[model samples]
Target: MISKDPRKGGLAGRVTKLSNSEQQNNPLHGVRLDAILEELVAKLGWEELGKKINIRCFNYDPSIKSSLAFLRKTPWAREKVEQLYLRTTKKGRK
Candidate 1:
């Protein structure tokens, strides 16, 4: 007999298939922004990097979508983010 619990992973398999549709279309498969940000933050303290960058998204409540949108239009801000990313990674190696 099938289980009747609504939360028993009823749609996960179907949702996973739907989610993977976009990945199949992209050459870069599963590149995710959160993973990148997490690595950056792990290496660099939130305050150190956030203040240096000075973008509202990074300084205040940061979201991947907002940060991406803000960075796309602001070259300087994007540069800061990239630079911070590099610095954080480099520091982590030492």
Candidate 2:
């Protein structure tokens, strides 16, 4: 049942609340793509990232700007990068 009044938390308000709650358990919730790339590069370096994800952006003439552009345009590559980040962060915590 959706509330009619926005002040009383309508559909949009409910969605916002749900989204905020869901993000609490999500590793990438508050992380930006550039920040993710920076962390991965700092921890793994471009060579290892290239080897792990096999993306040309990382393997050939890698720069944060180039990588961010490519990843933003390419969904599959972005997913790989995000997955690698989640894995790396989890490992670091242990």
Candidate 3:
């Protein structure tokens, strides 16, 4: 049965709708974590990334697979990486 109220579908439906709306506004929406790492490495190199983000994965012994694993588990580090990507690319776009 269809509900007249949007919230009547409950939490899952509301979360899905919120997610879709957020995706529309997020530049990193459809972008993969690996892709973001790859682009950052390509543009900045491991040394620079480590300098900027100060993460052990990028500093000590970097590999795309390892970095991806670390970033996936570490939200703060992942957010730093995404912010760097956005900041760097935004300037280049101009």
User: Tens-digit lDDT track for model 2 on 26-65?
Assistant: 6677689999999999999999999999988999999999
Expressed as tens digits, the lDDT of each residue in 1-94 for candidate 3 is: 1124555545332222345766677787768989889999999999999999998899998999999999988878998998899898863243
Sort every candidate by lDDT, greatest first: 2, 3, 1
- Estimate the TM-score for candidate 3: 0.75
Model 3 RMSD in angstroms = 6.6
* Structure candidate 3, residue pairs in collision: none
Ranking by TM-score: 3, 2, 1
What would the per-residue lDDT of candidate 1 be over residues 9-53, giving only the tens digit for each residue? 573333233356665654323534455566666666566667777
Per-model TM values vs. the true structure: 0.47, 0.74, 0.75
Regions of candidate 3 where Cα sits further than 4 Å from its true position: 1-19, 91-94
Question: Between 1 and 3, whose TM-score is larger?
Answer: 3
Best by TM-score: 3
- lDDT against the true structure, each candidate: 0.61, 0.83, 0.82
